[model samples]
Target: MSREKLLEVQDLKQHFRTGKHSVVKAVDGITFDIYKGETFGLVGESGCGKSTTGRSIIRLYNATDGDVKFRGVSVHGKKSKDDLRIFNQKMQMIFQDPYASLNPRMTVMDIVAEGLDINNLAKTPKERQARVHELLETVGLSKEHANRYPHEFSGGQRQRIGIARALAVDPEFIIADEPISALDVSIQAQVVNLLKDLQDKHGYTYLFIAHDLSMVKYISDRIGVMYFGKMVEIAESDELYKNPLHPYTKSLLSAIPLPDPDYERTRRRVEYDPERDNDKSEEPVFREVKEGHWVLCTSKEFEQYKEDLVE
Candidate 1:
């Protein structure tokens, strides 16, 4: 593992056994590195294992195989209780669904203070209460709101509470799994901005998983595209948008709506014809298209990519 890397995920695979014979490969052999203080975006269609990857990285689900290293320590495999607890404190996850993630029975104070209490981060009740108030304020909520229940708040407020809960432990890395998806469109920007501001202020690393390409492009330093439980391409955000190489990536990029109606109507959509290309074969192959840019697919495409590079 590199010293600069905050979270190093190597060949991570998560499989679900579906009875006596069948299995669902939710995440298969995907590898990526998240450096400290950088937001690494994982974008894909729903049911493409974006959330699964996020969950697996945070140890919400034990990986079937592969290694997830936080700092220099391996988080997976057998470990002592103390070591695991330390790793848990260093990394935390913000779930996708704001409505279901929070406990309706618990007040906002209890919800945000739960992690701090579990980790023994505070010495006394007064100290914990103060910490909870500070966390709520950090996420743009007033201290008075802490007495209210989750049902009293709006979707965006609930999500902010979730963010505050994740931040309570002072985690170095966070898996933000579609943090703004459940909120109203008008409120989404506010949540995104809050996250960005938090990152800037606290120097937190994030694996921001979302299906929205534009949002991912806006928040991410680099992006990785996954399809059918496989990582098809990964590159710097600007380079990926400007020069997407994989057929799947091109198709995904084509789906993003343009601002002008006339240009939107005039622009041709890049259609991925599986029959015409036969690029979905079981055999996996990845080639380097440019510095720090990788594409996984067929040999012919790799050859064509090479020719294009030369030209």
Candidate 2:
């Protein structure tokens, strides 16, 4: 992957106000970069703001605070219609639920060609049909299925349709918000492999959001661990897995099941109770505990991590 940054999310926060006047901190101040041609995995438990982060960067939700930059252009900032149109075409998203993401009223071709239609990428009806057909084949769907409704397909096939739609605009970046979570375990691999192959062919960057750590490890070049709307740690995939710094990161890694039966039985899971565990007085600062590895911690923890490296 190139060292050039494709997207930069700086101190992003998304808050929702409840009827009771309480603010829900869906995504509170997380920062990271996705390098060009690399999959940046964001992993955490349910409701940890993984999807919110993806949506915020893609401008699906207006960010409450902070900046999202794509190729030096502010994503959430006001822009001319032409610039916004370019932004819309360059960035795309794939939702978690395949069944719900596609419109039942539309055929697979119409759904896949939605982006092309909106962007006026195709001029003629024949061109649109050919483009849709090409996208379907690219995602491993048959041309015969192009006229079929989403209800007629299985979960995995529906997701393949979603992928085809995301690729319709020829996006350079894709925010995959838990793309495989709703699919069957057996079919999940196929979808993931399809994504990997597509990336290989197209060199697209990804913000792959998921709670499934194992699958994230398989697909991600680098991984960022999230907990309760905060980024706990980030590092290269194997480095983060082998040397998890934060308590939250360690706890998350411990939950990943081992393939060996003996190890699985003997492994002790790390428990994380944020209330009793993390210091709530001061806000956590992300520091480089090692080169290319960052951990959110107080000054004391940073020193401790430094000392541990020496020892």
Candidate 3:
């Protein structure tokens, strides 16, 4: 991973007002950075605000507070048409549900070419057709598949269409929000491998959001564990897996199933009891307990984590 920062998210909050008196904090005060040419994985259970973080960063939903900077420019607040256009071109998103994300009415060719059309990336129909064909092949699809509608393809194929659309504009960064979760288990690895291959070919930076820790660990250079709309741990992927410091992270890691039946039978499951672990005296803060590992903890818990690392 490159040391140059590609994206910076500082204290991002996304809240929804359900009623006149009720509010939901979908994403509350989270911060992280994605470096150029690295895949930063965001993992948590469903509804843990991982998806919301990706959407808010891409401006799909207006952030209620904090800042998201791409390169050096702030993505929040009002901006000129040119600025918005630039932002859209530089950042793209692949939605979670491939079945719902694609327009069933449009042909695959039109779907993939939409971004190219909007950005005027291709000047002529011939150029557009060539670009669409190139993208289809890049994502392991054929030129013949382009004429078919979304309903004609399977879930994995539909996701490839989504990926083609995202790459049509040649974006520098992509936010993949559970792109493989909707596919069959057999197909999931195919899609994930395709993404890794693409990233390898084109030095693209990624904010890969998903609930599958095993899959995330496979593709990510760094990983951040989220809980209840807050980041509980952040570290290099292997480091986080080998030495999990946060209770929630340990609970999450312990839940990953192995192929060995013997190991599965013997594996110790650690249930996360927030009531027992949380210190209500003071709210815990995100602090670095080691050179690159960070965890949300109070001073007392921080000391304990440090001693645990030593031992």
Best by TM-score: 3
Candidate 1 per-residue C-alpha lDDT over 161-199 given as tens digits, one digit per residue, 9 for 90 to 100: 999999999999999999988888899999999999999
Which residue pairs overlap in candidate 3's backbone? Answer: none
Worst 10 residues of 2 by lDDT: 302-311
Off by over 4 Å in 2: 279-282, 309-311
* lDDT by residue (tens digit), candidate 3, 75-162: 9999999889889999999999997999888999999999998889999999999999999999999999989999999999999999
Q: What is the C-alpha lDDT of each candidate?
A: 0.89, 0.92, 0.94
The reply for model 3, stretches above 4 Å from the true place, is none
Report the poorest 10 consecutive residues by lDDT, candidate 1: 302-311
* Candidate 1: stretches off by over 4 Å: 1-3, 278-282, 307-311
The CA lDDT at 8 in model 2 is 91
Candidate 2 per-residue C-alpha lDDT over 1-311 given as tens digits, one digit per residue, 9 for 90 to 100: 43998999999999999968799999999999999999999999999998999989988899999999999889996789998889989999999999899999999989999999999999999999999999999999989999999999999999999999999999999999999999989999999999999999999888999998999999999999888888989999988877777888878888989789999989999998877777776877999999889999888888877776531
The TM-score measured for candidate 2 stands at 0.96
- TM-score of each model, in listed order: 0.94, 0.96, 0.98
Judged by lDDT relative to the true structure, which candidate is superior, 2 or 3? 3
Q: Considering only N, C-alpha and C atoms within 3 Å, which residue pairs clash in candidate 1?
A: none
Each model's Cα RMSD: 2.1, 1.7, 1.3
